[model samples]
Target: MWSMLMRKFRRFPVFSLDKRQWMKNVIHQEVGKGKRVIMFYVDIVKLTEVENRYGDVIAKRVLHIFERILPHVSRQVFEIRGNILAIQKLWGDDFAIYVSFGGDVNEEDCRMLSIHFQEQAEKQLNRQVSFVNREELRVHIGYAAISGQDIVKEMYTSVKRAAHMAKYGITSETYTHVTQFHQVLAEENVTMNFMPIVHLPDGETLGWEALARGPEGSPFATPSMLFRYAEETDTVFRLEHICRKRALEQLRYVKPQQKLFINLDPRAIDDPFLLRGEVFARFEQYGLNPYNIVFEITERHAISNYAVFRKIIEEYRKKGYLIAVDDAGAGYSSLESITEIYPDFIKLDMSLIRNVDVDPIKQALLETIVQFAEKVGCKIIAEGIETGRELETLIEVGVTYGQGYFLGKPDKGMGHASGQAMNFLRTMQEKKASVREEPFLFTPAMSEILAKTITVEKHVKVRRVHEIFEQNQRIESVVVLEEGRPVGLVMRFALYQVLGGQYGIALYYERPVSQIMNANPLIVTKDDKLDEVARRAMTRDAYHLYDVVIITGVEGEYIGIVTVQSLLDKMASIKLEMASSANPLTGLPGNVQIERELNKRIKQQVSQMVIYCDLDRFKWFNDRYGFETGDQIIVRTANLLKEAVMRCGSGDDFIGHIGGDDFILITKAAGADELISFLLEAFPLFFADIYEKRGLGEGAILSMSMAGVCMIPGLYENVEAIAERAAYVKKRAKELPGTVFLDERDCAADETHQTQV
Candidate 1:
C-alpha cells in the first residue's frame, strides 16, 4: 500500500535509505525550473503520550494518520533522520513536505493550507479512534519558502529551523529561528557539566553532580529553560534518560571511586524501563559501579504514593545505588519525603545555605538539621556554598559535604578542588586541632619559648666555641647541630670547667664538639604539648633537668630550644587564668571556661551531655530571703552538683554556672542520665531545710528543673546552640511543672511535655 502511494506521488520517493537523496533531487529539479518550493515540516506532538498509554501498535496507527493527511497538503515528502526517526518509528511522527509553486505564491495561501491541514488531520484521526479525545491528537507545522541560489542547502536549513521554532511556539517570516526541547532531544544536542561535591573541612572531592545544558546559542541552552520545556511537553523522562546516558559515557573523566550524582525527577521512579536494570546495565557498560552512583531525586513534585515510591527506592538500594533527597528545605514536602524515604544524603537547598555565615537563624536551622541527620544516620550536604565564610560556617555546623561555586564550578572534566579552598581547609584543620589539644592550657611549645642559643656544627673547634661562650656571658648552653638537626648540647659551666683544666684545652681544642657536648640531649617536637614537655623535663636526671629541650620539626630538623623555667612559668600562668575564670562561690568553672571545655569536646567529636539546670522560683526566694542566705543556697547547690559528678560522672566531667541560679553540667552520654537522676533525687533533700527555715511548705519551696541535651560533638555550630537549646528545654520543663525533663528528640527537642519525669 505504501509503495502504491509512492508510485502515485512518483516525483518524490519514501524510503529509509534514499530519503536525503530524494529531497536533494527534488529541490534541484524545482530550482532548475526557476520555481519556488515552500517546505512544510510537520511533527506530531502527542505521539509520545499515545505510545506510552496504548502501545507501539496504536502509536503507529496515529503516525499513519499524519502520513495520510500530509499527502493531501503536498505530494513531495521527506522523512527526518537520526533520533527523530530511530525512536519515534516510521517518519517518527515528524516529516517534511514540499510544494513547488511560482514566485506569485503568497503568505496568505500558505497560512490557509496550514490551518486546513491541521483541522482535517484532527477530525480524521478522531473519527478513526473514537475512544481517544480529539485534543490528544495534535500536530505542529512550520513552513519556509526556498528560492535561494543553493536550493537544497537553503531549503533544508530553512525548513528545519522553522520546524524547531514551531515546536516551541516561535514563528517568523525571516530565517531567524529558535531551538526547542523536542528538536534538541531529537538531535541529541545536550551536554553534561559536572560540579564537585567536597568535604568541607579538607576540601576533598567526594563526587560530582551532573548538570545538563542544551546546545549553545539555542533557546533551550540553559538547564532551567530546557528542563521547563521538557516538563511542559511531558518529555522529561526521555530527556533525562538521554542526559544520564551521556553523563555516564563521560565517566572516564571522573575518578572511578568517586560518586556520580545524577538528578532525576520523581516520576522516573515509576518508569518500568528505568527500574528494569537498563540504567544499571548502562553504568556497567561504562565501567562504572552502581554503588558509586547516587540518584539525587529532585523533589519538584510531591510523591503521590509514598509506598510505591519507597518500594522503588528499596529496589535501587538493593542494587547498591544510593539515594539523596535534593533541594531539601526548598518546599514543605521535602522533609516529609526525607522522613518517608530516609535517604542516605540530604542536600540543603541553596536558599538555606546562602550567606548562612551572616545569618543566625539559618545557622540555627542548619544546626537543627545536622542534629536530625545524626539521629537518622544520614549525611547532610550543603549546596550553593558561594563564599569562604559560608564554607567555614558549614564546617562549623558539621555539614558532611559541600558543593558551590567557591569550591569549584561545574565544568566538563574530572576536576580538583580550588587551591584556595584546600589551603583554607588545611589551616582550619590545624587551628581546630590546636584548639582541641590545648583546651584551657597554653603550654607553649619549645618553638614558642625558644631561648636564643648559639648553634655550632659538630666540627667547630673547641677554641671557637669557648670564645663564643666568653663573648656572650648570658649564654648558658650552646647547641651542636649537624645539617639542621640538633645532635648535642654543651653547657657553659661544663665547657668552662673542661677548658679550665691544665690539659683540657689541649685535649679538646680543635676537636669536634661531639666529644665535649652531651650526646643525648633532651629533645621534643615543635607540636609537643607544653604540659607534656614539662613533665618530661622534670623526670630527667637532676643535673640535666635544667638543660634546654631541643625542638625539631616533623623531619627532625632543628628549630629552637626551651629551658625548664620557661615551661614552668607558662603552665603556672595557664592554671592561674583558669582558676580566675571559675565562679568564686562554687569553685566551678564559669561561662568562659565552660565554652572552652565545650569547644574541646566538640572538636573531638565525642558524645556528651549539656544539662541546663535552673532553680524554679529561685528569684522569689532571693527576694524574700537575704543575700547571704541566697548565696548559701547557691553554694549548696553547686556543691551538690560537684558531689554527684564525683559519684556518677567520669573524671572528664565539667560543671559550670551561667551565673545566678542557672548551672551547666557536661558529662558523657552514658553518665548524663545517672547524673541527672542523682541531682533530681538529692536536690530536694538539700532544699527541705531552707523551706522549713522560711516557714514555707514543700510545694512552695523553689524546685530544681534540669533540662538535658545529649548530642555528639560536630552536630552543633558552637556552645551557644547547645546552651540555647538547653535553655529552651529548661523553659519547657518549667512549664510542665516537672522537676526533671529530657529533650529526647536527639535534636532541638520540640516534644518536651511528653518526655517529662
Candidate 2:
C-alpha cells in the first residue's frame, strides 16, 4: 500500500541535496497538466539543536521516524482532496510535498488542508515512534497553494515563507512560551521538589529524588513542559545547570545518611559545571556527603556511545557518587543501558509497575529483574506504586525499594510515606490479608445509573411543576422538554426557595416552565461516560451546584436524569471498585476526556474511527454462569481488545470501557480495518476456553460484537456523532449471532473468523 502511494506521487526515501530542483520539476509538470499546485513545508521543530546536542545519529534517527510516518499520515489526511504529486526533503530537517488539486480548488481549501494535515502529522509523530525523550517529536507544517501566475522557483519559497510566519508569528504558542522562557531563566525562577524513595521491605524513607519546577502559573511550571521548551530552544544544558544548582541548594534539607537522587539527562551529562568540578565544589558547602548523592540517569536521552558513557560514569563513581538508571523499562535503550552501565540501582518504569499486583506477566518480569539486580549487586526500585497492592507486590517480588505518589509525592519539604500504607504492608507481611474492594476502576455511562426522573414539556405551567414537586417531595429535579427534546431543568430546592418567598407563586404561577427552568442545565446523552458527566455536573455554579443532570438520547429526547446523589453514589462505587480491584495502574481515560480528545481530532476534519464494543448475550451469560465467570469473559475481552490495539494502532489510540458489557476504541481510520480484522480474528477464538470451562460447545459461548463508526472529513463533527452512529450500529451487531462487527459506513456485518475488511 505504501509503495503504491509512493508510486502515485514522486518521493525520495531521504532528504536529497537536489530536492529543490526535484520539487520544482514536479510542480512544473503538475501545473503543465492544468493542475493547481500546493506546497507543504514540513519541519521537525528545532531538530538542528537535537543534532548539535545529541549528535547526527540521533537526529537522523528522528528524521527517519518522521519520514516513515509522514507518507502514511499525509495519505490519510490528503486522500479526500487532491493527489500528492511529490514529496522530498528540501533542506536540513525541512521537507516539502507538492500536491495537485483541481483548477476549482481554492486557497482557503489548501489552508484548511494544511492546518488539519499539520495537526494530525504532529500527533502521529509523537505516537508512531519510541521518542528519545519526554519532549514529543512534533512538527510544524506550513503550506502554500501555487497561483497560476507564480514562477516554479517561487513555489518552495512560498511554503518557506508560510513556515516562517507560522513559527515566529506573534500568535504562535512557541513564540509566547519562548518569551516566557527567557523571563523564567533571567529571573532564576526554578523551584526544587523532593519525593521520598522508601525502602519497600520496611517502608522507611531511604532517599529523596530532586525534581525541578518553573514559576507557579507559568507555561513552563510543569517539569515536562519546562524541559520540552528548554530542548526546543537549545537551552537544555543551561536549564539543567540551573536546576542542578537549585537541587543542590536543597541539600540543607537532606537528612544525613539519606541519599539525594538528582535527575541527570544524558544530554546534560557533560555540563560545563560538571566538567569544571563546580558541582563537586558545592557539595561541601551544602554539607553533603559524596556517597549520599546518587545521579539518576534518565533513559529519555539515549546514550549513543556506551563506551564514552561508561568512562563518564566512572568519573562520577571515582568521586564517590553512585549511578542509577531512571525509568528503566520505558525507554528504548534502558535495558541495554542496564547491562552496559551496571548501575547501583534500576528504577523500574511506571509502565512496568502500574497494576503490577494483578498482572502475572508484570510480576514475572519484576521477579526476573529483581533476580538480575541481585546478581548485579544492585537494588530494584519500583516507581509509581500508587496503591497498597502495588507496594505489597513489590515486596513480594523482592524489590527492595520503591517511589511514587502512593509512597510520597514530590514536595518542597522532604516527606514520609503514609503511616496507614506502611502499617498495612507490615501486617500483610505477617498474615494473609482479606480481599477488600477499592472504588470501581472503570467509569459507568448514564445508561448504567440514570435516575427515572419526572420530565415535563416546556408548555407546562410553572405552577404545575411546583405542585408536582410538592406532591412528590422526594423528586429532587425535573427535566423540561419541548417537542420531546429536553430544553431546560427545574431543581426542586431552587424552585421551592423562590416559591417560599412572599407572593412568589402568585406572581408567576401560570408562566411557562421555561421561565424559571435552567435553560442551560448540565445535559449529557445516556451514552456519555459518567466520570466526565460528573465533572461537568459539578462545575455548575453554586446555585445549581447539586442540581441533577438532565440525561437525553442522541436526538435530545429526554430520557431521565442523574441527580447529584446518584452521581456521588456511582463515584463512591467507583472508588470502592478501585480499592477492590487490587490494581491502581489504570490505563483508561474518563468519558469526557475521551470525548474532548476525539472531538479535538474530529474538528481537524481528518478521517478517524470510533469502535463501540459489546459482548453478545452478556446478560444471558451472566445470569446463567454467575458474576465471576462473566467477569472472566470481560477480562478476556479487554485483553483481546488491548492486543488488537497494541498490534494495529498507534501509541495514541484509545480503548476504554464505557460501563458493563460496553467498550469504545478510537484510532486513525487508516488502521481501523486492520484493528477490526485483529479483533474479529482474536475475540471469539480467545473465548473458546470459557465455553469448555462451562461444559458448552464453542458455538454456544458468549461472543463479541463491535459497532464501528468511520468518521470522514466534515461527516462527523465530534465524538458524540460517532457515538450516536455507533450506538445504532451496535444494536445491529448485537442482533446478529456470534462474534461480529458492523461498521456504520459499510453497513455490513463481519461474522466470527470472517473479516469483511
User: Candidate 1 local accuracy as lDDT?
Assistant: 0.72
Give the per-residue lDDT of model 2 (tens digit) for 1-757.
Answer: 9989776555434445555565567677778889888777778888888788788988888888887877877788776888876676766777777678888886457657766877788787777656455576567776655654555546644654556534753336665566567558656889998888987656778788989999998887899999987776667777888988888787777654477888898878876565344654555445443456788999888889889988778666544467899999996798899888878889999999999889999999989998887666686778888988888788877887888988788998888887776787678654432221211235656978877878898889989998998899888888887888877778887676545544447645776766556666788898787877886665433345677887888787888888788898888877665455422233344564456557656765567888888887888888998988878777677667766766677645666666677777888888788888888787767976777778987657777888888877788766666777788888888888878888775564434326643
Candidate 2 ranges with C-alpha deviation above 4 Å? 1-166, 275-277, 432-757
Count backbone overlaps in model 2: 16
**Cα shift from native, residue 47, model 2 (Å):** 19
Model 1, poorest ten-residue lDDT window?
80-89
lDDT of each: 0.72, 0.73
Residue-wise lDDT of candidate 1 within 645-746, one digit each (tens)?
Answer: 766876567778779999988888876777778887888788778778789885686678788787676688787887777877777777767476556463
